[model samples]
Target: MSERQKPVLRVAIVGAGPAGIYAADLLLKAERPFQVSIDLFEQLPAPYGLVRYGVAPDHPRIKGIVNALRDVLDGGNIRFFGNVRFGTDITLDDLKRHYNAVIFTTGAIRDAELDIPGIELLGSFGASQFVSWYDGHPDVPRDWPLDHTSAAVIGNGNVALDVARMLAKHAEDLLPTEVPANVYDRLVASPITDVHIFGRRGPIQVRFTPLELRELGELRDVDIILDDADFGVDESDERSIATSKQLLVINRILTEWRSRETGRASRRIHLHFYSRPAEILGSDRVTGLRVERTAPDGEGGAHGTGEFREFPVDAVYRAVGYFGSPLDGVPFDDRRGVIPNRAGRAIDDEDERVHGVYASGWIKRGPVGLIGATKSDAMETVQALLGDQSEWWSPSEPDTDAIPRMLEARGIRYTTVQGWHRLDAHERALGEAQQRERVKVVPREEMVEISDPPATAQPT
Candidate 1:
């Protein structure tokens, strides 16, 4: 057959987040020997996974990433199958039968574990769960317990900052954002008055972005407290500050806040550097956090100083990091919480390539990097996938329509691209009525119902 008459290369990407969308975008744009057809499947009814569900509602700057991902999905070069799960709605064997290759980009959803005593206390929580609750993630419970007046957030990353800011910010301040009614209602009822953020390393070693660190001070009615002693920096820390611009800005901001007079804000956020969590104290619930002071080890790391201090707090949130959940048939490394892969190609227990299967983003590598970094990561995965086109699994008479047929036979109420557009319009309409940006639909059933196309219309 002529090159123009060759059958299209069908590819299925599981997960419609930035990572998966970027992979689809690259695959569609690549100069390949055959035309490519891409299908992006998402477990949620909505697209832009983390951008829509994980980002703090108040952070519009970061949420602006949705527009770029939207452009790719709106290009019509790819088909979006929302609300379709992999393990349940469809399986690996099903995907292989319909497409030439499959890519998994289900980014990490669970929080990384922090080994510490009393971590299972009643008041101890994972920052990821709190983030999801406040972000209006459909799967999480609508009501989050906020009885604690003081909370301790352990981590130095952006997520840690997000959790701290959310707990400390006045609910009225979040009104203009896309916070759902359920989340807003619960947040306003929170008795939280103080939120302490602890980092195991020095100020120069914090993983938070400069903007996020700056935003902590911008919260209304919240005073940022930094102990004068916590401001100590060694020669090596100073060297790191000079070398990394982010570190320099972050350190400068912290230093400036250290000199500021404490205001009578109703809420307070305490940023403590060089404090490592040794234990979460309390018999029934979190009443205090036992932390150990640390000093720079002069090798760009920290060493415990053997000085123990306990801060009385009602709740504890561990925001150390995130870890990937295992997919039904994917080869996962339990220790690393990532799919075993080499340059995006899935590897088996023997470390041999699992042809036709691949991974990208946090699942390919560990949960790290921002959205921009995720795009670059996708590029690498896509390049590797394209390079192995010669060895890709080709099903006899591959039919892209088979997967949808299977879902229909199973009675799965899947959401389509058009359905998403309708859902988007519905949200915008809701926001218009309320005179806000957009009011998110929190319940999964509501989202699926609203995003579902008319019964007369067939699934695309």
Candidate 2:
């Protein structure tokens, strides 16, 4: 066949998150020589991986990104295959045989390990798991333990703030949000009154954004507490804060909170800086957290000052960071918790590029950047893939229809884009009855059943 008449460039993106969707959008818009066909596969029945399952329900601004992603999927140029597990339903070999190239945009899901004494204690928990539970991820249990009256959150990032805020906020205040019914019920009965957030570094070194930091103080029925001593900024810290507007804004917010007198609120979020968790104190369940005082190391880091103090708490949640999990047949760097890749191209042990295989987003680069950063990351990966079109795998039969046929033959009842629309509408309808935005469906079976109903069922 001639170059002009050759088959369309069939690409399989093994993730339906912002990264994968952005990849598809970039590919469709790229000034390529030939036509392309994109297919996005997701493990869940619904699309928008992190937006639907990772972001806190109260963060409507962050969740608004889903609308743009939805526009890309509704453009009628790409196909969405939901409830399709990458390793189990389809293998790397299956993708290589069917598509010209495959891009893995499966972003990080698990929490980075926190090595400390008593980390395995009964009341100790990973922030990612707790976020998943509160966010209504189908993979997590419907119920979460909210028995702790006072909790300690260990981290300096936005996620730590999210964990702390959720723990301290009144559950009824979240009714207008998209929190699932079961999660709301459990949160309503929570005994949490005080949440202490610990950060090892100084205030300027914290990773939370200015907006997220400001929102922490805006929570209803919650008092934002910060020790005046924790706001001590050296010349170097002031210089660093001056260079970045975001850092300056965050510092200002913290300073303002520190200047305020302690309010009489039902719930409290105590923000502590320069305190490193030496150990989680407990026998079986968490009883307290032993922390060490740390001073600036002259550089941007901190060093222990041989001073320690313990805070009484019922539970401990570590929101250090998120780490990517390894795929069944992919090469992953265990130490870094990401796939070993060179500029979006998957690299072998010897650092050689694996032809027709690529990666993007947190899976490509370790979990660091935000949602906006994933778009540029996907662009780089897609550009690299497009540039290497000459070396792409030339499948004998790159039929787009063949994938759905294969999936049907295997008895995997996958969901399509149209099905997702139905599910979305269903949720909206349920929310309307309650005079709220939307109520998320937490169960995987219900999601699939709503999206892809049985043949005997009547259409809505």
Candidate 3:
């Protein structure tokens, strides 16, 4: 048979995030004449993984990437199955039975804890949880103890800046966007003033983009503080930070901070460098953090001196990184903090290919790159699938027609692209009525209900 006459390759991508979407886009546009049918699964009711749930609400330009993705979703070839979790609703056996190849692009969902003794204490929350709460994640618990005057985020990454900026900004500033009503209300009433972002390394080693770093100065009612000590950098360090234009922009901002007059700042985000969180101090709730000062030893590692200091804080957040969730029938690597994969093929501990299985994005690469990076990552996985097409197992001779059957069998409710558009329309109308940007329907049940047809279905 000619390549054109070859059977359609039914591809199941486990995530609807950027990585999965890019992969689907590549397969849809492949010139190889092999028919590729993609089923994109997302645990959330909405698509655009981190863009929707991890990005700060103020960054509307960043969020606009979702529009570009809508074109792909509307192409009518790829199927977007939202609110369908892989581990809970469906199993690996089920995906293999339905599709020829499965790509797990589910990004890291959990944050790395400091693992300190008082970490389990009340006021100590993970940065992921705080970020999710502010980002209006439907699954995040709403009642975070944010009613504090001072909060400390133990990291110097962009996420740390985001959390600090959120705390420093007024609720009215966020009212224009789509933050959850409850979270918005709580933030407006929050007494949080001083937001200290700590870094074990110096400011030169900070991972925030220049654009985000510069945005800190735009906070009208907020103060941006940086000690000259933090800004002090050697020749080698400057060269290292000069690779990206984003880092250059950050350097420019720091260079100009001394000349700018930032007025009317009751709430301020103080950027502190070379300080590491040694311990979180409190009895039942967080009261402060014990920090140790460190200096760069000319090598990559830091040398901590015996000297230490304490900053009185009400809440503490550790914005280190995120990890993938464990799914049934999938072999996970706790050490690497990802699903074990060999060149995109999901492998057991024995290093043998778990046929018909695959992985992509943070779940595959342990959460490092930006949205654009997913394209190449996904392409790599797709190439691997193309290489080993014959080894895949198909439980059904023909199409298992899993979508409709799975929806019926497990009473799984889902939203189509059109349905999502309708909900989008509804949200826009509501936002217009309220004189605000699209007021998000944050409750998962509400989103699911809108996604559902006339029949009443129980919430998941």
Candidate 4:
């Protein structure tokens, strides 16, 4: 059959984040046998997912990922529907009614739990929450508490470093970035002095990338403190570092910071390796962090040496990892915090494939890897979705206008690609007046108003 004569391959992608967008891009560029039509549904008024709301605003290099996402959305082939949620706003039934298949890429944004004594203390926080606040995520509260003088961050990854850097760096330094006004104010009022990062392994085994480890030292007036005892690596550790370039750079950065002089800077970021958090110390709130000292095991790992000590800090932030939330109708793996999928195709407890249903990104796999990794992950899902064309959904109302009409009748107040452009310009204008790159709009209602104003016709 001719391409136009065949039924269009209508696909609905949930979560317009990097994975979903990349999946859409790949499908559009794929050598398909039939015509395709894609619709990207986003929960937030703005898209780009974590890159927009999970990254540190101060890191413009990482934030530059938005530009690439924007290019794909602006291509005009894939339709974008912002402020349209997946579970409640539009259910799996709703998707099946409009498209031949659906792909879920709702990446994990919630912080993974750090089970320890006193972890529930009032002053303790999750690094993902702090990151969302600093990134001006509309869902989180505008104000973040920063009244403490000293804080402890748990974990050794880039997020742990970003949290420490944002807390330790002066607020004035963030003026050139896209930090929201409320975040800037809260940071400027912070009384933080010392921020300690705790890692459960030796320096060579840390999860930090070279660039993130290096960024810690570049902080203007903040001192990077390191303990020489953490660097006592045996022949096995030395050989591991020598073979892997990632380990080599990370070790080099730590070695450089360890040799640097301290006590002159206004703020300090102490890197404490071989320390596993045993408890958060406080009666009512976070007053200190108790950690157990670990010694290198002969192979390459570290084990608790039964020695414990407490570091005096007013607040604690856990940056261990991110966990996925369960969707309304999707089958989720509670323990793994992801959808049970085999190569991007959703599966049941019996391991039978759930036809026409898909998952990608952190929601498909546990939260791991950088944004760049999602490209290959997304391709796996797109290929799975395209290969299963025989088992596609038979939509009752496949007309493109049916959904918009239904949403309008139900007063859903959904936004469109034009709405995103409007909101983008508004944010830029807000920043242009301040001579900064851009100023993020934080409130959901205000963002919706600016993007899809009530006075104007509904954006379709």
Index of the highest-lDDT prediction: 2
The reply for model 1, stretches above 4 Å from the true place, is: 1-4, 454-460
lDDT on C-alpha atoms for all candidate structures: 0.89, 0.90, 0.81, 0.89
Task: Report the number of clashing residue pairs per model.
Answer: 0, 0, 0, 0
Q: For residues 1-460, what per-residue lDDT tens digits would candidate 1 score against the true structure?
A: 7967976888899999999999999888888778898989999989988888889999999998899999999998898888888899989988877888999999998999999999999999998899999888998888888999999999999999999999999998999999999889988899999999999887888899999989999888889998878666667777778888888898889878888878788899998989999999999888999999998888878899899999999999999999999999889999999999999999999999999999999999998888778888889998898899787887764776776777778878888888999889988889989889999988888888887755324457
Q: Comparing 1 and 3 by lDDT, which wins? A: 1
RMSD of each: 1.8, 2.0, 2.5, 1.7
lDDT of 3 by residue, 1-460 (tens): 7856877888888888788888899887866657787888888887888888889889998889988887888889887778888877877777777788788888897997577667877788888988888887889886667789999998877888888888888888887887767888898789988999898887667788887887887876887777776656444567766686666676777778856565467887877888878889999999999988888878755778877999999998898877777778888998767999877789998988898888888889997887767778888888888888788777573463657667667877776666677778877887888787777788898888776633324557
| TM accuracy, model 1 | 0.97
| Candidate 2, 1-460: lDDT as tens digits | 5666955899999999899999999999998778899999999999988888888999999999999999999999999999999999989888988899999999999999999999999999999999999998999888888899999999999899999988988999899998899989999999999999999999889999988889999998788887777766545888897799998898789878877767689889998899999999999899999999898887999999999999999999999999999998888999898889877999888898889999999999988999779989999999999999788988766877788888877878888898899899999999999998988888898888888834223457
Pairs of colliding residues, candidate 2: none
- What does the lDDT read for residue 311 in candidate 4? 95
Q: Give per-residue lDDT, candidate 1, residue 79.
A: 88
TM-scores for the candidates: 0.97, 0.97, 0.94, 0.97
- Any idea how many clashes model 4 has? 0
Quickly count the clashes in candidate 2. 0
